[model samples]
Target chain A: MTVNGVEQVRDIEPRLLLVHLLRDELRLTGTHWGCDTSNCGACTVWMDGLPVKSCTVLAVMADGRSVRTVEDLEGPFGLDQVQQSFMDCHGLQCGFCTPGMLMTARKLLDDNPDPTDTEIREAISGQICRCTGYRNIVAAIRHAADAEAAGRGDT
Target chain B: MQVPAFFEYQRATSVAHVVTLLERFGPEARIVAGGHSLIPMMKLRLAQPELLVDVNDLHELAGITVEDGVLRIGALTRHAELLASPLAGEHFPILHDAERVIADPVVRNRGTIGGSVCQADPSEDLSGVFTALRAVAVVRGVDGDRTVPMREFFHGPYETAVRPAEILVELRVPLQPGAGSAYVKVDRRVGDWAVAAAGAVVSLGPGGVVEQVGIGLTAVGDADFTAVEAEDLLRGRVADEYTFAAAGEAAATHCRPVADQRGPVDYKRHLAGELTVRALRDATARAHRGGSTE
Candidate 1:
């Protein structure tokens, strides 16, 4: 499997989850491993361009697939637009759910550049933020959309 | 962190390879699609298959097509794909209705309709929706293929009529002319497991009379996840409040629902009736509008 555009191959147990493989083996700690159950979006990542809860997906299932985690949010230029928006809008409080929220938000904005509030909420419904800070998280996503639009204007 | 128990894993390259593996592993082996349902259950130590066969790579078993007025959905077709399919939404609105609330979008990205049906969870909404739609299950085995009606496909909770070596490969829903369908579910929270859900398909005849009606209920029935008596009462009757209310009463009287954290028996029964009534009303109105919700 390729992690953030880097091919990673390892002999792992069939029972290992993608979250554990990414955090424990590959040391990509940006992808938080919270709530082993699929209820929390904390382990959310892009599996072939679609958001999937890594806690429920077996590492073996990711074979020959591309997995983009929150660690990929930054480029050579620094933080991605979505990450910058989160910082600008204070989308994080406890910061436990930030990684998953960022990943999911990036995908959401990529799919729908101008998603309504309802669409944004629906997109992140799988994730659980213990801090219950959904208001700013949603604002952060909107901010990202605005930034992208502004960036397009500049170009 | 929760993880599956020790098991041998094999990624099947083709349908023949899967059938051969099923033949070799027998019932102890489990065919994993998206693993949203099975993986969670496995981590809880509730279901531990000795061998796991991953069919995620079989792109052949993942598509949606409508031919000859029959909608064919592949087994590996993800819930997200089904929700986005214009073909599915056009022919069967009930599928879109259920898929929209099956789970959050992330989970839907991985959950497969085949796994939902094959799991045969009584609380599963798609089972009832499919049952109401009178869909057919295409099961492929070592010998050949066989089609089973969706209603008869489920034997009991967590059980199906799928043979040991047979895998459900596709679902065929016959598109009914002049038929409009709708599904309504009341879960505790957004995208949670449904407390009670109902699917209704109604076809209006000349003079706005009820030509035919189908009712499928979830989280209420014991083995058969449908309200046949309710459907019988609505079909051929006038599409009015009186007949709709009577149909609701029939559904509430027939199903055996138990009280749990979701709701009590009486409450679920009441929802079964009320949702049935609402679904019937919407379905009839949609049918009158020619089954297009654009």
Candidate 2:
């Protein structure tokens, strides 16, 4: 089975979570593992075209499904608009949670191109970013949403 | 956070195939609709089933329709769909309100109404709302199909009257015109489980008198409790301040809440009364008038 564009196959217990598989076996360190529990949303990723906590999903359950990480956020030069917004607005200070933040933000913008502040807050409320106090994170998302709505950048 | 070691898998193609597989697997098997609830429980090792019959792909259990003044919601219908549905949004606005505040968008996107009802979590918003609306759970078995009222379907905490071999195929709710409803829940966070919730449905007459009332309370007892006393107090009375206050007090008396991580039992009971009053007030206002602040 392939994960994040890499092809590999191995037999193991059904209990192995997709998070451990991505981190331990595949060595795709881009997908960071924050609280192993599903409460914290730092382990979020795109599974079969929906944003879900990878830590909560089993590797066998995600079989034959495409999984996307923050590594998929690059466009032409450096970072996607969402990530760039996060960097510009300083959405993260610790940087341990940037990947999950970017993926969740990407899905939110994809679903609602121009979401209100309340909508954006509700969308990312599942994720917990301890640094930057979430004010800048909300600002970054708003900037990206505006940029996307105005056709200014590749949001 | 690992899923249990056991579990054979079968991706069902249709409802018939799912029913056959369920019958074949018997008690050791469980159907996975949205998997939002079952999968999380499997990871916690609280439930270890030998077989998982995946009905996520069954097209039969995946639509909402209205016929004969009854709203028929398929079992596999996601909460996000319910939140976005125009029929549900317009007719059963309380269901829409309930779906809007249930968990975050991600959970709502995957969690299904059928899954929530079948899981029968007393703290769940849908269970209380459905029970208040008098929704019927349509079950399918080898013999035939049977309808179970939502009030009787949930026997206790984390328990349902559904049999191991029976599959919940659809939910039947009345689409009454003058009946206005609202689902109000108070939780620590916007998406967390409800500490105490209330779903109130009221039908008002031309003179602004209450014709009928249904109040269902969540997270207040072992199962979703219908405010029978409050309903009795509200029937045939004007939805004025005095009547509403009396009904609210009656409901507050009936709610039996327990203290846990959320708050103290006394606080929960207070919230039950506050939410009941607010939900009844909002539902009555909507029944009398058709404008929403949203």
Candidate 3:
């Protein structure tokens, strides 16, 4: 599979999970694994173009697909606007759920550049953030949307 | 920490190939699509298949289309797809209503309709919705293809009529013009399983008389997931609050619910009846609005 625009090949057990493959094998520790069940979205990653809980997905299911993890958020210039917004808006307290939140937020902005607050909440509803009570997380997403719109001269 | 037991995996490129692989591996082998349910079961040791056949590559089994007054939903259709399908929502609002609460958005992206229905969990929302729609399941085996009514699809909890050697490829729901349908559920959380849910499809004849009605209950343990007695009572009767309440009472009295972590027996039974009435009310309103559920 092409992970973060880089093709990777390895022989892995059929029962291995995609999150473990990314963390243990590829050493992409940016994606946190939480609540091995599909409930918590700390292990959220993009398969093809949609976000999915990595724990519930088998490694083999991603054999020929493209996976985008949180580690790929940075560009040649600097941190992506979503990451910047999270920091500016205090989106994380313990930072355990930050990766998953950032990944979901980035996708939401990509899909609907100017999403409403309700849409932002719905996009990240699958993920859990015990710290910050999700108020700042929602604010961070809204900030990112506003920043992106301003950069594009739409504000 | 949760990992499935060691098993051999094979990716089937075609539907015919999947059938061949199932036959080759025998009863202990399992076909996985989406793997949202089966993998969790495997990790918990509830299911331990020796061989896992991956059917994610079978593009033939991934689509939603309407043909000849029937809505054909490929078994591989994802819950997200169903929710986003305007055609499906226009034809059956019950489907859209059920899909909204099936699970969170991320999980919905990977969960397939076939997997959810095939899992046959008693609390599954789609099962009850399909039962209310009276849909048909198309099962393919080594010999040929056979269709099974949704009413007879479930033998029990986690047990389906699809034999070990066969694979469910598609679901077909015969379109009912001028009919309105809705699903009502009450879960503890946003994406939790329904404590007790109801799905209703209602059509009215001349003079505001009920022409047809189907009621399906979930989690409350209605045998076959249907309220046949309520349906029988509603047909040919005037669609009103009193009749709806009577149908709800019949459904609640007939269904058998057991106490579990979600609720007590009496509470679940009450939800069954109350949700039935609410669903029927919406369905009746939609029918009166010319079957346009906007």
Candidate 4:
């Protein structure tokens, strides 16, 4: 599978989950493993351009697909706008749910471009963030959306 | 960390290939699509299949199209895709209503409609939606293809009429002219399973008389997820709150619900009745407005 714009190959057991493959095999620790069930989206990653819980997906299922993790958020210019917005808005406390939030937020901004506060909350409803009470996280996503709109002269 | 037990995996290239694999692996083999439901069960050791036939690559079973006044939804159609289909929503708003609350967005992106129906969870939303629509399930096997009514699809919780060596290929919902459908669920949280839910499809005749009615109840142990007695009482009757309340009472009195984490038996029964009335009211209003809820 192509992960974070790089192709990776490994011989793994069929029982191995996609989250474990990324964290243990490829060492892409950016995708956190939480809630073995798909309820908690901390293990969320992009599979073929859509977010899915990696913990519920088998590594073998992604055999010929492409995966994008939170580690790939950086661009040549430096930290992605969403990463910068998180720092600006204090989106992290313990930082355990930051990666998943960032990944989901990046996708939301890319898709909706200027999502309303309600939209932002709905998009991240699958993910759990016990810290920061999600207010800062939602604000961070809103900040990123606002920044993108400003860059595109939509403001 | 939860991991599935050791199993052999094979990606099926085609429907024929999937049927062949299933026959070769026998009852011990299981076809997996999306893996959102099956994987969790496998992780908890609830389901232990010796061979996992991955059908994710089968493109033949992945689309929603209408043909001959029937909406044919491929078994591989994802929840997100179904929720986003304007054609589906325009024809049956009940599908959109159910899909919107089936699960969270990310999980919906990966979960398949076929998998959800095949899993046959007693609390599954789509099962109740399909039941209310009186949809048909298309099954493919070595002999050929056959269709089964949604009312007879589920044998029990976690068990479906889909026999081993057969794969459910598509679902066909016949379009009913001047018919409107709606589904209502009450969950503790945003993405939790239904405590008790109800779905209804109502078509009114001249003078606001009920022409046909189908009511489906979920998580309430209603036989086949249908309120047959309630439906019989509503058909040919005036579409009014009086009849609707009677149907609700019939449904509530007949259903057998057990107490659990979500609610006590009486509360669930009350929800079953109330949700049925609400679903019927909305459905009747939509029918009066000419079918499309949008």
lDDT per residue, candidate 4, B1-294, as tens digits?
688999999999999999999999899999999998899999999999999999999889999999999999999999999999998998999999999888899999999999999999999999888999999999999999999999999999988999999999999999998898999999999989999999999999999999999899999986589999899999999999999999999999999998999999999999999999999999999999899895
Cα lDDT tens digits, model 3, B1-294, are 888999999999888988898898899999999898999999999999999999988889999999999999999999999999999999999999999998899999999999999999999999899999999999999999999999999998989999999999999999999999999999998899999999999999998899998898999886588999999999999999999999999999998999999999999999999999999999999999877786
Compose the digit string of candidate 3's lDDT tens values, residues A31-137: 99999999989999999999999999999999999999998999999999999999999989999888888999999899899999999988998999877459999
TM-score of each model, paired residue for residue: 0.99, 0.93, 0.99, 0.99
Residue-level lDDT tens digits of model 1 in A67-123: 999989899999999999999999999999999999899999888998899999999
Query: Over the stretch B1-294, how does candidate 2's per-residue lDDT look in tens digits?
Result: 455657787777877787788888888898886676777788678888888887777778989999999999999998878988888777778988798889877667677888998898879888889888889999988888988998889988778878888889999998768778998999997689999989899888878888878898989883656878888998999888788778778887887888899999888888888888888988887787652424
In order, the Cα lDDT scores of the candidates are: 0.91, 0.82, 0.93, 0.93
User: Looking at candidate 3, what TM-score does chain B attain?
Assistant: 0.99
Superior by DockQ: candidate 3 or candidate 4:
4
DockQ of each: 0.91, 0.48, 0.90, 0.91
Segments of candidate 3 deviating more than 4 angstroms: none
lDDT of 3: 0.93
As a TM-score, model 1 comes out at 0.99
Worst 10 residues of 1 chain B by lDDT: B285-294
Better of 1 and 4 by lDDT: 4
